[model samples]
Target: MQTENVTKYIVNWLKDYASNAKVNGFVVGVSGGIDSAVTSSLCAETGLKVLCIEMPIHQAASHVTRAHEHITQLKERYSNVSDTRVDLTPVFEEFKTEVSLEGKQATVDMALANTRARLRMTTLYYHAGLLGLLVAGTGNKVEDFGVGFYTKYGDGGVDLSPIADLMKSEVYAVGEYLRVPHSIMEAAPSDGLFGDARSDEDQIGASYPELEWAMQMQDEGKSLEDFEGRQKEAFKIYMDYNRRNQHKMIPIPICEIPNKFR
Candidate 1:
């Protein structure tokens, strides 16, 4: 679809969903990335009150800087846009110290990262409750479904996923169409979950375009041997991630009972 059409479609969907749910507006955690930028712009486009938040838990300076720029851009572009910055480092530290690894039965790095996501989720909900807004997620198709890259009950917990159907490349297209800041459009995509500021590709082992192509091939039931050289390597990485993260993609299973028995 054309970018204009895509933008209109998502905006309409947001409006309809909110109206039916009786929610006042949208709240999104801006990571200074294209996905969140596009999502925020779409929410702002709906003429509803939009709160762009930055909850940093030992977040890098560069990421926070970009976030401020993005929030400023949004405020300039849309009257409904407002911004807030809440440092989650102290909260995360307190929680970390209080909860021992022995008690949680989890590793330090992963548990901390997941805790960061959950902390942001908590901040979002806290603000949402105060303002009567629904949490708007920024996860795109590849990250949300293809690789299951988000933390369950963390970034995964959202009232609406406006861009979840669009792939990473498709999200860039929407960002361009919305005239999102060039810095964000060109910046390396990252979850900003780590202290060293690792890009998503650094962790995922492939670029968004590469993963997108692999996902397409996976959906088509095509063999990895369909391509040669580096493309095949990408496919292998995609498959590995896909296999390991399938649990995140699938819904929780439920038992069925007969109505007659009830």
Candidate 2:
């Protein structure tokens, strides 16, 4: 679909979500990346109070700087928007102490990364609950649905996802249509966990364009027969992530007991 139509669809979608949930606004984390920037812009355009949180740990100064720049640009374009920065160093340190009792430091990197994300989610949900607003997730089709590049109950948890159906390239198209700052649009995408330690491309060993192409093929019902052995293997990895993280994409389950009938 065209950018304009997509934007309209997103705006209307948010409106419907707000009306149904009885929320006055929406909250999103702005990580100085294209996806978050695009999602924030869409939320602002929907006429809801858009709260952008810049949650950076000790290692992510660069990402936090860019987040400020993006927020400035956003404020110029939309009226009902505000931003706040919360350093997550202390929380992460505490979490590390709590988990270090296991004597397993090998997973510390991944655990810290997830802690940062979950801290941001906690803050977002806190403010969202106070304002009676929904939390907007910034993940795209390539990451969340295809590759599962989010932490469970952390960044993956949200009330709504505006860009969940759009690929990374399409997200950039929407960003361009909305005139998102060139700096943000061109900056490398990262979770800002380790301060240039690892980027999305670095972890996945592929660029967004390549990942998007693979995702499109899968979406179109293409099977392993349509790809080479290596490609099929990579596709299997992606599909496995999606399958394993299904619980993260859904609501928590509840148990029920049968009642005797008269």
Candidate 3:
């Protein structure tokens, strides 16, 4: 696709929606990854007031560096862009420990990781509420829908999603067009949730390109056997993620028969 046009479309979309809402501006969580970097740039280009929040919850050193660098670049480029760093380590720890000590069910690793995302979500909304700005989301189509990789009610919660329609590859193309920092564009994708800093591939079981290809084929009504050999593995990973996380991708199921009477 024409990435230049895509960039313009996203920039204009942000501008239009923010104007229609008549809010203060946009609030984005800068995660120091390609998705967040690209989304931040697009929001800045809108020329509306933009707040780039670096909410680091026990993040890696490199994560801090990249987020700071990107925020610095944003400040240099846009007069409307504003930013602040909020460390959430203590908050996350307190919440987790307090729940366990109160005789509540023990929180598993996965549940705790999800809590981290929800914490970030709460922080973003807190700023947006006080500032009267919409929380601009950074999830792409692949991660948000294809594999349902995002944490539900956490990273998945947002007022608006600028890149939710674009696949992972398409997002990178738009990032290049927007002149996103080369280092960020080339960096390995991570959710920044784990203690060890695992890449997205390590967590998702397939590279983005692989997921994109498999998702494309599924959308096209093609069988996995069409791309036999090495691709079979990618397809399998895609199916596994989709099957396990399908609930996150769809709306909460309701009892239709009982509801119909209402």
Top candidate on lDDT is: 1
Assess every candidate by TM-score.
0.94, 0.88, 0.93
lDDT of 3 by residue, 1-262 (tens): 9888888888898889988999978999998899999888999988999999988888888878888888998999899999987889999988977775343343476778888899999999999999999999899999988999899989899999999999988888888887888888888999988755689998877899899999988889877677777798899889888889999988899866775687
Superposition error at 140 for model 2 (Å) = 1.0
Q: Can you give the lDDT of residue 237 in candidate 2? A: 59
lDDT winner between 1 and 3, please give it: 1
Q: Estimate every model's Cα lDDT from 0 to 1.
A: 0.90, 0.82, 0.88
lDDT of 1 by residue, 175-262 (tens): 9999898889889998988865789999889999999999999999977778889999999999888889888889887798989999
After superposition, candidate 3 runs with Cα above 4 Å error: 101-107, 224-227, 256-262
Winner on TM-score between 1 and 2 is 1
Pairs that collide in candidate 2 are none
Q: Residue by residue across 1-262, what tens digits does model 2's lDDT show?
A: 6989999999999988898888898899998888999999999998889999887777666677678888998888889999887777788778777766454564766777787888888999998988888999999988887777888878888998999999888999999998888888878788776656367877766677767777777779887677887677666656666677777666689766667632
> Pick by TM-score: which candidate is best?
1
RMSD of 1: 2.2
Q: Once superposed on the true structure, which residue ranges of model 1 sit more than 4 Å away at CA?
A: 101-106, 257-262
Model 2 per-residue lDDT at 30: 91
